[model samples]
Target: MSSAEAAVPQAQWWHSFYGGLQKMGRSLQLPVAVLPAAGILNRLGQPDVFGKDGLGWNNVAKVFAAAGGALLDSSLGLPMLFCIGVAIGMAKKADGSTALAAVVGFLVYYNVLRAFPEACKAPTVLVGNQCIDYASLKAAAATYQNPGVLGGILIGLMSAWLWVRFHRTKLVDWLGFFNGRRLVPMITALVGMLFACLSVWVWPPIGDGMTSFGQWLSDLGSWGSGIFGVANRALLLVGMHQLLNTFLWFQFGEFTKADGSIVHGDIPRFLAGDPTAGQFTSGFFPIMMFALPAAALAIAHSAKPHRRKEIYGLMTSVALTSFVTGVTEPIEYSFAYVVPALFAVHAVLTGVSMAVTWALGVHAGFTFSAGLIDYVINWGLATKPWLIMPIGLCFAVVYYAMFRFIIIKFNLKTPGREDEDEVEDVTKA
Candidate 1:
């Protein structure tokens, strides 16, 4: 077996780190998995189902849209998903009790954090160097109470570790009530409160940072979107690209409806029938639906003559996955570490795609990843959905040529073209 296949030794630092990241990734599955359904429902709710303008709203669509509201909101669906997913993913025995503790923990964490700025009389920071009055700000901030996905992930990790550590601990006979699963909730609550209190000092700086960066991106305009796109692609290596989206897609600024209703986030605004959604997300469509798939084909074509069959099957499957499902990790990971330079170029091209999408005023947000499925349903709402296809075709050609040229010129070890002695037998697709 290859050294990469060897099991990481127990109780080591790297093992612990790896295990933690794996847990975070696993906890994301339930929440992430549900988004496609939310996207479908939201799209079904939109008036223009067949990609044409002037269709009146459908009753069934409105019902689906209303029902889907529960799932699409970050504070509502995502937190609960984090609670259940983390508890289940992290439990040694997958006990219902662990999940129960997680629920308690999740509620307490956000409640405490939200109450902090209020209890301390911290003024609500607003757009353009203005702050709302502290008394009124308390009510508005309390109403929002969003911690983003990172908070949920952290709470999950903490609660999971606490569950594993103390779930089996024995207490003195007189205090046995606090020893088992029952005790987990109380302890988790206290920990939640502690973090909530800590967040007063911690959360605001982050908000400020996001505001500053958001302003910078806004100032840069189309190029800023492009830069964000590239950064999003590059951050996949560290598995934290969603951090950037939290600001732009969520609450960097407010969106006022034509009827004077207010909303937050790209997806929320889009679902609320806004024409301009998907500022940060739309660019990903061209890259995922066309460019990367073409890159996959190029990888297949460039493989050694003897390995073409295996390469063909693997790349084709991953290409389809990227185009249809909006999941590009399989194709990306195939060459991520092996050909870092090519990945950098991919990031640049992603930036360019985002710039082009924004420049053309084409907008369509997704509840999940950007792909053909979302692009189709959201087409009518988009400014120029037709433009995406032609742009994507162009990007596909660029990616294909780029991949072929770079791989051949540098003798990069991409999948089937890897050195004979270093073949990776496991095919992810």
Candidate 2:
């Protein structure tokens, strides 16, 4: 067999493994993401959105809420979760070393950034007034209570990559223990600290910029949601969606808390399933869970007679995944690389989904994307959980029918609709 053919099985195996890991990560994110939000909301005096109230109605009845608050205060909530999530998601082997490196990197970054002002401290009498209080210093530097889980994830991924790339190289015999996987965490911590130092000293204003940008997006209202939805998908093509999400979801300047505090970090976390917390994510459910799959169905139904069965099987899987998990890359990449026009249509539909959700004021949040899992968590924890199911089903039917009709009418070259020669060559070769 040719190298390409031989490699296909390996690729498939990797894909399966990665897909499973992604699902696991998504599952973990649901609870971890909610905890911080729940805690914050509890502190702010909001009852459980899930309707857990009773006659007693004591503040301490909020078990999740109390746990969430402790997690946030300890700084072990989102940061630690992000480190583990990113490490496992990106690592080639799912090794413990990768996770260790991620954790170390996050700690390093946190300590470095957290300590810069203290490091710069001179005697208070000489400088005027007492040495800056740590909190005041952090606030002045634009570093809030949370630096953001997204930032932690990025650092974790970077650390894991570094470990993978250089684990085998030997530099010193005396420091053998620090080589390979063992050294990943140390390196991560060092690197993070360095970055933190640089952030506080040379580039403090960057935080302000992030905050301003988030605030600007927030101010745009429904139009902002539509723009975010379109831009998010567009950026995904170039691998910049994470950066955008960080700016919007994290950063104190971007969002104000119910208590009027300038809160840093995710809007969803701040609101904890408030239904109004995840304005950006709310719009996505209709599109990913509904519209994309419908498009896929359209393409599948339009396929040539001989290829119809094969195409249906493929599209069926894609549709289910999109509906349940909100991971559209599998379905999208199938057509996007081959049929640019169809992909464009998909993007337009995404924008429409955002606009529709915004118009209806259906707000919900997720750590990952707008999949069924997130829909359930946000909805269940939200004040109005019942609304999601009915709304979601409606979108699903619309998406499937619309997609099917479009594919048949336009003769789009979706998977099953490939030319006869293409199929023959694929099968024969």
Candidate 3:
């Protein structure tokens, strides 16, 4: 056989699926890394940061809030970030023009939707079924917020892919005016318009579906949140869970504020000072704040005594990352890559944690991940905040015991416990 044919082995469908996920995870790094700074800014600016006593810095708080919130909450900010981040991440050359083209394409996509709402609406999914929340849906058409981050991601990837394909194409001399990078943005715009028009025709049913799903999840109450929590962790394995967050956190509800004003999305409503913001997010506190760190400790403890120090160093850094920022992927993927079964258990535990917390009627909001920073930031506005610490401690013990037993029993190679070559490699890191 030829060298290429001999080296390449056919794989099952699951191999392709996993390969795609790994690629997605790599592409997400840039966008994800930028979140911490914005999150910190938002935490600083949130009300009650200075407490009821620090009345003097109230204006300062507002200034900080505006400064940070602008990056996330502003119209251009998030879409632009996604476009550029995804473009750079996916491009082989990582060209600046690729990123610029992506941004322009994304804007063109939304601009079309905004300019012609009626033309965009598909026939009602059930003909007579309410396609979407009428007033809010209409508002979204004007504001063009429903497409959201998922929309930005779709456009970003498309723009980048188009740039890569046609960027170096050579045109005849007569048509040379529209050659190279100059041709990219224009073609990207046309593609964006096509997708936007398609969205106009296609999104009604999808929007209706999103609305129905949100309503169903809300109706299921804590149980629904628990299932959502499980799905969240499991999907995170493939780096797709953020898509669900877009619906639940941002596009789910017509949340009303204390002033009798209404807004869509949990985050925007919470920032508007709504108290119901935490139902979907609060469940993560126990898992991130206590359970994951505890699990990390267990993994370290299970390592051979000679390797304990090295294991401790790696786990300690990742565990700290998880606890402080709710960035669990580092610690999670470390083990999940080696012991897939253990990851399943982690996902299940996350569901139970969310259910238990929601059942107890605790609520807390976070702009970032469900890390300690967000938990503390929203605590003053949270429901049953005091119960979180005690409950979290209980979870800590449970995760520790469970992870230790499973890893030891299975001899799972979780970081420090890897075989000879893996051990040396992990220690170096």
Candidate No. with top TM-score: 3
Per-residue lDDT tens digits for candidate 3, residues 146-262, read 465557777878887888888887789998988888789889999988988888778778878888988898788788888889998888877777656766775567665443434
The per-model lDDT (C-alpha) reads 0.75, 0.62, 0.75
User: For candidate 2, lDDT tens digit of each residue in 1-429?
Assistant: 999999999999998876644443443343344443544344433353422343345555455455644444323455566667766666666677777777777877776655433333432211221244554453222232345654566676677577778666665999887777776666777788776666556454665676677667767777777888888777655444555665566433334434333334555453533334565666777777777787777777778888889889998998899888788888878877677766676676677676767667666665456777666655544534455566666766776776677677777777777777666565454
Model 3 gets an lDDT of 0.75
> Candidate 1 residues 138-250, lDDT tens each?
32322333455556666776788888888888899999888877788889899988876776667767767876877788678689889999998897876656555655765
Poorest lDDT segment (10 consecutive residues) of candidate 2: 122-131
- The local distance difference test score of model 2 is 0.62
Ranking by TM-score: 3, 1, 2
| Candidate 2 global TM-score | 0.69
Distance from true position, residue 54, model 3, in Å?
5.1
Candidate 2 residue spans exceeding 4 A from truth: 1-76, 83-95, 116-146, 161-188, 238-240, 250-267, 270-276, 380-405, 424-429
Clashing pairs in 3: 250-265
Question: Following a full C-alpha superposition, what root-mean-square deviation does model 3 have from the true structure?
Answer: 5.8
By lDDT, the better pick of 2 and 3 is: 3
Checking candidate 1 for backbone clashes, the offending pairs are: none
